[model samples]
Target: MTQPAQVPDATHRSVDVPGGRIHLVEQGTGPLVLLVHGFPESWYSWRHQLPVLAAAGFRAVAIDVRGYGRSSKPRDIEAYRMLAHVADNVGVVRALGEETAVVVGHDWGSTIAANTALLRPDVFTAVGLLSVPYAPRNGFRPTDAFAMMGGPEEFYVSYFQRPGRAEAEIERDVRGWLAGFYGVLSGDAVPPADGGDPHFVPPGGKLSDRFPDASLPSWLGEADLDVYAHEFERTGLTGALNRYRNMDRDWEDLAAWDGAPITQPSLFIGGALDASTTWLADAIKAYPTTLPGLVSSHILDGCGHWVQQERADEVNRLLTDWLRSLPGRARP
Candidate 1:
């Protein structure tokens, strides 16, 4: 894998939102493209995309989503609910002096970006989803589905529901935990088919127990690990973990839009080996009705969960090409 390029002329700033401040790193100048990251990661996750998007003639800004990095972490669990995140994105665009923007996200952020476009199409003109496909809210409660997913062993999402349960496991060894988690989900160190699944925690066992013993992926370096570890180490995991704690709340909050489709122009890219893509293959197939405006869809063979990082050059070309293809873009 190619080493990440040092972003040229990157600038850092913070914007005040409803209840707290959001920290972001921005590069380039032109039509705004907001990059939102997923769990256990910060704005730095988009380090590879910043310079490329900037050079492509679009202002690329990646933010530390609320409860991660330097962003304000609300004390109440409800504060981390889905609507709060959507509100934060709206604040970000208005704060940046733009009327509308194209939003892209990965993992949990993918769901967030989809909801943002679905809820406020006027502000988010376009959307891009990486790693996870868009699945409209379903009939069943999220927790109920997750509970049934694990016949006996606790699904990782279910394990994260209780307050301080996963936090205790992660805070014990942030660096090692992060390295192990990133390793198992990455293309290079993905768990074997017969191996115990990392997504399901054995009774009384931690998720790290399933993490394979291995070196970091070629796409991730020691320095990169440090950036992630230091942030979680300083901030603690409560704010981040609270995201999982609010899944049931999100279900209740978004009941109005159940089965709704994101009608804005959209893009999707996922790793072939990623469970997010494999488990949700139906969602990808349903894109015709669910994501009718999707411009393109791709599954990068041999890649894993971290799509943009593991395959930076390929993802960059795809992103730039798709962004340039968007109708009515004044720049590029």
Candidate 2:
């Protein structure tokens, strides 16, 4: 790991990329580790991991993806295409004056990091994916996959595909929507089985309608919640929603890697209690086949979808350990 020229304690700054200006929170002074945040989140999502990575001899640059936070939010739905997202990230690395670095992502960002590695391994040498596993492109539109899932009107992604509808509901009450979504998705929130009405989220109603009283989890504090709410209030979910609108476009864009596998060294960290775990269990099982260079796989018992935040220490340990394990990762 090579050190950065000047690694400050912590700083928020802007970097001009090809797509637009990106707001970032950076720390540390060693090998570059770019952290991409997911939906309904900003660069703040990686606050906990930033210092940890910095301490472990890494230059951690956590950026708000194009749509969210202080980054540019192009109104055109087409602007949020997958290829554009990948390009922004690649440009961020170049803008930072680095050739290559480790790439890490969570939730939707997981897809970003994985695809970035798949698409440009020369730039992202090693990869770390949290929450979501790497799903290979199957030459079908993402909407097609969701349509095949064939759920009720409440099938979340299907509902999101309707455009203006989701944004209307979510943006109507940004803070409430944030609290509701975070509340229901956390590890502590149990999904109702036996197909009950008024599901954790119904197909017709708003996200805030399901849970009247929204509270913060241990990992997510009131101050943290406030930060998220403030940013969402400023951005108004348009850019984030636009990403969903580009689902089919992303599927169309990634046709080049139909059967291609992510050949770089990779590590996956997921939560066992997370509903995503059940489906991804098989993916992890088949990881050797899908991610041929997978170094290890771990599912923390009782952890949930918000694995990195819910269990910051564990996640940081897993991430730094994996980076150290990479060939030539040693630094003085």
Candidate 3:
């Protein structure tokens, strides 16, 4: 697949992975920092962080995970599983001509990054996660999540696991889906001020309605939203939705590790206002207990689910500082 036009201060590139071409944007010239984005978003999610990292003297790279943006979109659901996702990151780092890189991930990408560091520590010098906490293998099940939230009514993730239903619902109204996802990230977009009320529902079942109403963070603008919408429009919801469908398989696969903790220095960042914080509260606190190297956790005020994009300046500052503190800098 062809790469998209390079955004100013960043240039697009593709690296051939096991499945097909992997799309990435690289900028600056120092230690390498690879930024991985999650669901319903592309590398564009890190648009704000790229320049800041680069300006701070690091070669920042943001990638479109498999099946998102211009990257290869494989039809097989297994191809999107955790092991494959980790392999893809290994391939990207190797392909970039770097032996190791400072790896960072958000949302689904956070899961992958955590697993990558655990399963393939050679490829990452350090790791950072956002939004989601590191739920160890056999940590908790989706069914457990549903029950903890007081049944299906309070959990969107459980809703994601319903085969064919979520894709059909989101695809049936793409605009509303995009808007809802967008709304949840910005503090001003939702009805209950928190995304958890059983009665809370976005227009057309859209997820963005969960967000607050202020303008999106400086990092995300109408143009960025357009870019994401266009990508979703092309791929539809099938590929993305498949991610949720594989949760059981992911859980099973991860279970083999039996609570293996991430040994590398790590950081976690999230929007204080995001409902996910409520969901993973205990897991976050217990992370350091499980992984001795887990060093910091920050919850940005006024931000929601999309913490990086919703609070770009603060996220960028924290990320740059964390990157600088890594044991060894990227040679590049």
Candidate 4:
């Protein structure tokens, strides 16, 4: 897991959107490739991809996704709904002076990217999803499905519905919490099998209580941890957690696209050990229907939740190969 060389020409700027501004870091100069990150993470999560994509002869851009990093944080929880995120992605492309571009994401961003491609296919011609698979909107309420997942304990999503519940637990020690959370999810270290499930919170218990106290993941360094902890330390966890509280709203908002499939060129990469892959195996199996335009799908052996970071070289190769394979996006 050798780290990629630092990209020297990378630059940062903000683009004006309806609600506020989006802060992004970009490099290279070819076809536009917009990258959206997921929960508890920022553009920094794509540090490895930005350089690789740029060197592959394409312009690569990664954003802070509104609630994380330097992006604007709207006060209302409803503002973080799925439609709002889709709008932000649209605004980013328009603000960048491009008519259309490629959009890729991981974790929650995977859903956001899929919706963006679904709602505005004209603007995002191609899509790539990592860590999480694309599952179209369904008739059932999201909260109801999550509730049934945990028999006695509360699912993590349900636990996050209350505004200040998870905040209090995480804010108590941002650094330690981030470390434990990241460590337990990486393939290098997993939550003990004997211990209770990390996805469910015991009655009257905290999520971090199940986190591993082991060292950081192989790809994450002390400086990297500081970068994440510093942002949350200054901004608090309200903005980030707001995304989880809007599950039902997204389900309701995206009703029009119910059972819709992304028809644009698509790629999906997942970590074999990641719960996201194991839990949603059906989604991948249904890719033939849900992701009709999917070009390829790979589940990296021994990898974990952090697909891009944990296996930077392999992810970069897959992303670049897929991008080049797109019609007219190929480099010499």
TM-scores for every candidate against the unseen true structure? 0.97, 0.92, 0.88, 0.97
lDDT of 4 by residue, 1-332 (tens): 22222347898888998878998999998999999998888888999999899999999999989888788999999999988999999999999999999999999998889999999998999999999999888889989999998889999999999999999999999999999888888888766554888888888888877888677889999989987888888788999999999999999988888899999999999999999999999999999999989999999999999999999999999999999999989987
lDDT (Cα, tens digit) per residue for candidate 2, span 213-290: 545666788877878888887768878878778878877788878867899999999888766767667777778888
Pairs of colliding residues, candidate 1: none
On residues 1-332, what C-alpha lDDT tens digit does candidate 3 reach at each position?
32364568688889998878898999998877888898878898888888888888888999989888778888988777788788888888888888888789998888888888888877786889998888787767755755466343445666666667667767776755676566655555545465455223443453433544555545466776677877787777766767766776778887778788888899999877777777679888787676678767898777777888777888888887777777765232
Candidate 1 versus the native: TM-score? 0.97
lDDT of 3 at 103: 86
Summed over model 1, clashes come to 0
The number of the candidate with the highest lDDT is 1
Cα misplacement distance, residue 1 of candidate 4 (Å): 32
Error of 1 at 308 (Å): 0.7
The lDDT per prediction is 0.91, 0.81, 0.76, 0.91
lDDT-wise, the better of 1 and 4 is: 1
C-alpha lDDT (0 to 100) for residue 294 of candidate 3: 74
Ranking by lDDT: 1, 4, 2, 3
Candidate 2 deviant stretches above 4 angstroms:
1-8, 190-203, 212-214
